[model samples]
Target chain A: MSSSATINRSSAFSSPRVGQRNWEYATLYIFLAPFAVLTALFGIWPIAESIRVAFTDSYTALSDSPVYVGLDNFRAVLAEPAFHSSLWRTLVYTFLSVILNVSMAIGLAILLAHPRLSRGRTFFKLAIFLPVITPDVASFIVWKWMFNQNFGVVNQALLGLGLPPFAGVTQPGSAFVTLVLVEAWHHVGLYTLIFLTNLQLLDKSLDESAQIDGADRWQRFIHVTLPQLRPAITINTVYALIEFLKTFTVIFVITKGGPNFSTNFVSYYAYSKFNSAQYGEATAIATILFVIVFAVVAASYWYMEKGDQR
Target chain B: MSDGAVTDQARRSAVRATLESTVLYTVATAIALMFVYPFYWMLVSAFRSQEAILSAPLRLIPEHLDLTAFQTIASIGGTPLSSFAFNSVVITVLATAIGVCATGLGAYALYRNPRLPLFTSVRYSFLLTIMYPHMLLVIPLYFVSYKLNLLGSTLGIILVMSLVPLIFFIFVQFFRSVPQEMIEAARIDGASEWQILTLIIVPIAKPVILTATLVAFLLNWKQWFPVMVLSTGPETYTLPVALISLNTEYGINFQATMALSTLTVVPVVIVFVLTQQRVMGSFMAGAVKG
Candidate 1:
């Protein structure tokens, strides 16, 4: 309230009344300088450099300057069977993980939002959200132990359930599933919290009105509840998509993109190339990833804006 | 079609309600356990011997607690565990402090001057970067650090990390929730813009600011890729990198790895436990409102 008054007072004091606009501009510029300078140096410049490097045959071993062998890096990346499998795997990973993660989060959020469970809300929230705050590398390493082929708790539990012990990270498909499960576990807490917040904000009167209209619990949730949580759903969907797309740490630590590159995500692929000093090829992979991520996010935002108009 | 039949239906409905409530409590408790069990396991495993950790059917309760893994960490590389922790603390604290201040001030400027060209472009650019993952920049960032001679330096990590786009967005969301009248009131009292931000705005915005700080701290604390790429040696390594090194150097020493993992997560867990309500509330409020 006071901020609006200050804004009006300042605006009124501007121009002939007081000449403060120039001062305001100067201060604004100062406030924006750190962001601008850091972003230009690290963010924008690096992005541009990656694009430029993508076209050349740049590698650390080459003494000569990078030649603009246009399309060669991209061509090479496309030709590699490794690249093909990895790209497909990454897409599948993103699609499945986002669906499972977001839906589970919503379910958990709804359960936690129940009025009957109010007494344990903090404990439940803290427990669920704990993983999201834990160090990713730490959690990944611990999960690696949990998924260990011989001594993994998961397999041990399976064996206890009268099931045969199966290789975890040593296999192809199972490795992917393990990675996805770990990823979902690490992330669902955050989305659940987001959904919980939106759930709490929902007008209960609307739910009551639906109930009065003879809608059952499931019907009320599907009809009156889900539609109202669109903003949170959109946010979570895009966030989960982006997060899954750039999932490198878990795959890097647990599998190292092994078991025939089953879990070889694009980001990890790029990092591996970079490690081997294949700078041009790595940047090309990164550029392709950048394009895909940009398109999806932009399209999602556009779709949401269109929905808002209706 | 009598009163007896109506009573029977009412009793059935009551029984159904009880059954439903029981199911809800059961499912919710199970999910919470699944979420929290791993950390509990990690803590327990950290205190177990190598034999205990690798036992076929893992024991939820160890026969005896052992700290050999912690002992290994304590004497690792002739540098104490505290040194790695000290390095992590220094890096995370400085980066978070600088990052939070820059993010808050930048968001405030953008919030106040919504239509200004400089502010608008910067604001949108941060959003654009949020869409583009940081993996794109890591390689070039390595080169950038090398060219600037910031490699293997704490200052370099702090500088690069202080520009995190998501934190910027979080701050922007928080500032948007701050009513303009707050600033207006401060200005009407002959307060400068800086004074307004410091005196009137920041105090009211403490919760979100703290949330952002916690997030910034968490990111820096858990950061691996940047440190892995930029740091040249152990001297400059943060806790995450050190933990990774512990794993690689020790060769499947699950006990030590678990112990180190526990150590790595302790500070963050402590901070989260202490301020869980305020931090989570502030975080969600920003998202919900904005």
Candidate 2:
């Protein structure tokens, strides 16, 4: 019904006369003025300004005048060993975090899809989804406390189990690992809900036929259920990849790029540069990250479109 | 003999079903508990004394009712907690209301008048903003804010955050579902396009409005990064910023920090409790339907 309305509307729009078009366009401009103005100021213009700033030595505090430094800022950012390692660390963090979080979401979605679990569905859903909605700073604060070396419940639990307490956030390696875990915990619920909704809406007849053909549950899942879940997988993977790539608050609150900059990702690196008032350098790093994210999202979207064609 | 064997196999499958269900329930419960325990601990620890919090043996239950943490948070560094709370409430409410109005009206316009070259171009620009990485824009936004003299003001924050493409996209999705007949009737009744939107369309799209409002509210309430970069001092800080600054100012006071954290979290949880079902359902419905 809606699709047909859309078609009819498009036909009407395409056939509208030129003389009357001005009046219609005028009305639309009036309606769109607010969004257009805001987007220009905050979104488009700033993006344009970022590109301009990326090539110049611009510092807000140091000087109002920006010197055209050509590719010096980009060259400096690329040459820094810190930049390379942070980029690598960010990739590793995103990779591990996406895998863990997406798998956990799928696992939980499968469990929640159980017919027998319907009675307690809302309880579990809200319990898991609560973290996704909570304020980032507040949630990070709690988790930071949870990872406290001396009094954190995690270390306490380890001690109770008769193993030595790990310096959770004080060390570089464990701190990075801890960050990945906390991030996954904070975000997995959203993907779980996404996958869960997709799962519940699945056409059950395909799986039923598979079962009737003497396929075991695992076999049916592998052959029928998994293939049908391509759309959800695409959505989850794209979203998770983008999210992990832009991770900031958890690191900001807990590690501050921590013991030897082990947990420093590109986002935090850009932020730290901004903290030092190196606007050109900061925007350069940000531009690099933006291109990376854009490429990943575009690639995934293309892959999904191809899958649909298949 | 074949019939008997079939019955035995059916019984065996039933047992297996029950076993799998039990395992599923147990795992689900454990995971929920694991996710929820830290929040539970945050609540319990807020009322605990500092020593009780730091003691070797962890106490799941509060040993005593202590108000020191709450007291400290209320009067920390001569800034009243109410001031920060008031700032957050004002910022969040204004941002949500303004954001919904802007996006809702704009989306309705786009939906009602499609394929107009100019509007289509503008619509695509908004959509482009939706996918563009915001990190790159932060530096330039700061520069823009500095030039416009909007750096330290709540209204500035509201303006910057409210015109976001996410809300616009959500509104566009919902507005697409609005039936055309209703608008045509309004038009024939001598109503203007604005009247059609305000009088006919908005009343029918209450759920979308609510969903957008809730999401914008959540996003603003939890906003800390922009506040950190844009706002200058304690006077302009929101609740989340205030809590972090308090954490920094008063280190080793976990009790007070937790108390402040709980206080910072209370309104969001209250909002969530009131509208969790509608909000979650709307989000899932929107994503799935799209």
Highest lDDT model number: 1
TM-score for predicted model 2 compared with the true structure: 0.92
lDDT of 1 by residue, B1-290 (tens): 68999999999999988898788878878888988888888888888887766764377887777978888888566667787888888988998888888878877787888787766777666666656678667787887787688888889888887775557757777676788887776666667677777787888888777778887887678887787788887777777888888767774678888888898999899988998886676556544443
Q: Where's the lowest-lDDT run of ten residues in candidate 2 chain B?
A: B281-290
Stretches of candidate 2 above 4 Å error? A1-21, A59-64, B1-18, B185-190, B285-290
Residue-level lDDT of model 2, residues A64-165, one tens digit each, is: 776788898999999999999999999999999888988888888988888988778888898888888888798889889988876589989888899988
Question: Of the candidates shown, which would achieve the greatest TM-score relative to the real structure?
Answer: 2
Evaluating just chain A, the predictions reach TM-scores of 0.90, 0.91
Q: Across residues A1-310, which tens digit of lDDT does each residue of candidate 1 receive?
A: 6556456666775462355656667888898787777777777777777888888777532334657888999999999999998899999999999999999999889889987787778888898888888898999898888878665788888878999876788899889988989999999988899999788779889999999999998999999999989889998998888889888889878889988888888999999998998988999999999999988888987998898899
Off by over 4 Å in 1: A1-19, A60-66, A203-206, A209-214, B1-17, B77-79, B185-189, B285-290
DockQ of each: 0.53, 0.48
Overall lDDT per candidate, in order of appearance: 0.81, 0.81
- Residue B256 in model 2: lDDT: 82
